[model samples]
Target: GVVGGRSVGVPGTVRMLELAHKQHGKLPWATLFQPAITLAEGGFKISARLNTLVAADPHLKKDPVAAAYFYKADGDARDVGVNLRNPELAAVLRRIAAEGSKALHEGEIAQAIVDKVQKHPTNPGKLSLADLADYQPKKREALCHDYQVATKDFRVCGFPPPSSGAIAIGQILGILKNTDAAAKPLQDGIPSADWLHLYTEAARLAFADRAQYVADPDFVQPPAGSWSSLLAPAYLADRAKLIGAQSMKVAQPGNPGAVKTSYAPMPDQPEYGTSHISIVDAFGNAVAMTTTIEDQFGARQMVTTSAARSGGFLLNNELTDFSFAPADAQGQPIANRVQPGKRPRSSMAPTLVFDKATGELLMSGGSPGGAAIIHYTAKTLYGVLNWGLMPQQAINLPNFGSMNGPTLLEEKRFPPATVEALRARGAEVREMNMTSGLQAITLGNAHGKKLWMGGADPRREGVVMGD
Candidate 1:
């Protein structure tokens, strides 16, 4: 399923980095690539994580070029600590460093990408040289909201539409804030049943609205007068009234902004893939960026030079983010349906939080888990801002929430009583692997000096390093 042309979307990470650097970079543009280029050219030990992923992947081995590079002659995945060198990738980065992003978007590298995509053995894609050449980065206003919890004032800002993150998270947290749930403190060192019940119910309601109205703003108009209409305090209060002593099982989208609409709610679709980066420059500017190839070893096809001399780079399968079914059973269109040149809907919530009064950066955090990203981000936000946990403590908290479906608690984390409590409230509970790769850094004091404390999810191999 992963190997094909349909999986690829025009790769955007390069353009994203380019835009970020253009706006906030203080170092010489080419200087930034030195470390990566050095690592690629000099050969680095293959990480245990990379080895395990290579061995676990069913399709990567089938690509001759990929197999030759990642596996031994016996076909076993290269062992951990193997000093693998990618002169080609290093070469690619060197070109980008010298020539800038256009090296990847145009010229020989771009041609190779197009050829590999359209000339695949079986699952060739439609990407062309023009699509790659035509790519342009977008600049939009950051979405920010204020929250007051027990006299603490904070402002949360996140990527706006095209990404359903900030809107959905704002809706869920806002709805919860409007309820008694806001005061349900942690019990026995964990979130109490009452707290989770209210939280998950609020999640269900938020996801229901997410399915209905969130999409690329270029193509789909916000349901209400503006995107903010959905997050209006009054609107959230009205939506919160739907939560009761028992679960609604599934909640339906509310009519916000009181606008007439014709779009059908998109059925829950599989959402996956991404790597999150949270950065703070010396100048105090911070960025939270979540980038992905849509799935692991995206597109299952690797791009390389003609003789496969340059090795390979994974292509993104992001186009799959679109609703496969353009219309619902009633013939009404889904707002997220695929269209030419439209950015697909995403749950990638790269978020930045700041102190309300001073406007000082408070936290930069995000995760990778498709639709569940909303819950992962919300948990971290609530953990750090509400319960006063350290960033790591918050990142370590068990993942739980709904995709407008059955209540899902991370398997083996919640006690049986926790499960029963939700079921007692009529929540259909399911426990399973909820692997979230969360990277976060919080600003606070240690002793007397200011610090930027970092937390990487215990669920993955992420690490925090800074000067």
Candidate 2:
């Protein structure tokens, strides 16, 4: 089963956060963790979402530590709105807050993590103490691209390689610009079938290039010696030419600058689970972050100092993000194939936008929908920048996207006519659960004063807050 130690990758959250705090944080390091500690120590009400996930999960109950904390004696999930505490997590947080990343990466916490992975009864992992201790977060250049809508130009920035986010998003939007999609506005607050047809076609082309070329930069080189080659205006225009009156159904990867890669395209596979956060602080600092554990309740294995403890956190099945089959039938290696010390290509696109002329911050946004993250984020950017919708209004629009296959729409959200319209174009349309947990905050003018606005996805339990 995917829910066990064999799926776990070395945890990186603590190290990543610590690195960010050290560089940009103004408050004392310990002060930053107090709220989470307080919440875990005191308790928080279980929401409908949590209760439903617990009840629905067939494997969560298999772990003794998780089964006890999240369920009743009868094995039913704890009731919604009931106060639940996780003192063990609180204890873990406290130690980390006090001792920095070392607490988790070097000593007691690291031991517990390694033990949980290596000693799993059914599926054991190879995580070692040295792996945890030696893990170092590397800061890479943010991929920024210039985008224009009508007369306004913006600079969109996103996470770089190892994350196929910004490059893919840039390609989609760039390709759309080469088409007439910009002229087709949203009909009644939702994207029209005409626009979606163009958008999904663009998505198919972009994803084709993604599976063919994107991977950890440390392992695979970008086509034509630069990632920007994929987003080049000339290249996008050529790609746009492929989209005719009908859907292409599936697209083949374009050779940017006529450059061919030795790697084979990764086959289509399931990608799942992540959360997004978009924040604009009082002092003008902003953060758009997307974190994940690769699957729901990730690996379904909980780790604490001891089984006697009632609280702990789940391990991530992040390694599974790699292409399971290392090579294709023709013997060409997949770019995202798993390798030691190599990060898997991901669709987590945490993004920020700035006014190109003045370099002023305009928006911070991102979404969690695994591979659909590219589409979710591109939709919000298009809605706000192209259609002039507010952040909340843009987020409230129904989620939709195509991952180079059948076009997907949020179930029951799109009109019947819209679905039939895509089908008429020889496109396969699937309306299912395209749940996107999108969060966005934009700088806007209100009553002739500068203001900050935030929006969260209503499909999931998220709320916008400000003091």
Per-model clash counts, in order, read: 1, 0
Regions more than 4 Å wrong, model 2: 258-261
lDDT of all predictions: 0.87, 0.91
Index of the highest-TM-score prediction? 2
User: For candidate 1, what is the TM-score?
Assistant: 0.96
Residues 164-196, candidate 2, lDDT per residue (tens digit)? 999999999999999999889889879999999
TM-score of 2: 0.98
Residue lDDT tens for model 1, 1-467: 34677668888778878988998677898999999999887888888878988999988877776777788989999999999987778878988899988999999999988987888788888898899999998999988888878898989999889999999999988999999976788776678888999999999999999989988988888876588888888989999999999999989999886545579999987888688989887788787889888887777777776465536587888888888889999899999998999999999999999999999899999999888888999999999988999999999898999988899999998889989999999999999999899999999898999999999988877889899
What's the lDDT of the predicted structure labeled candidate 2? 0.91
Position 215, candidate 2: lDDT: 93
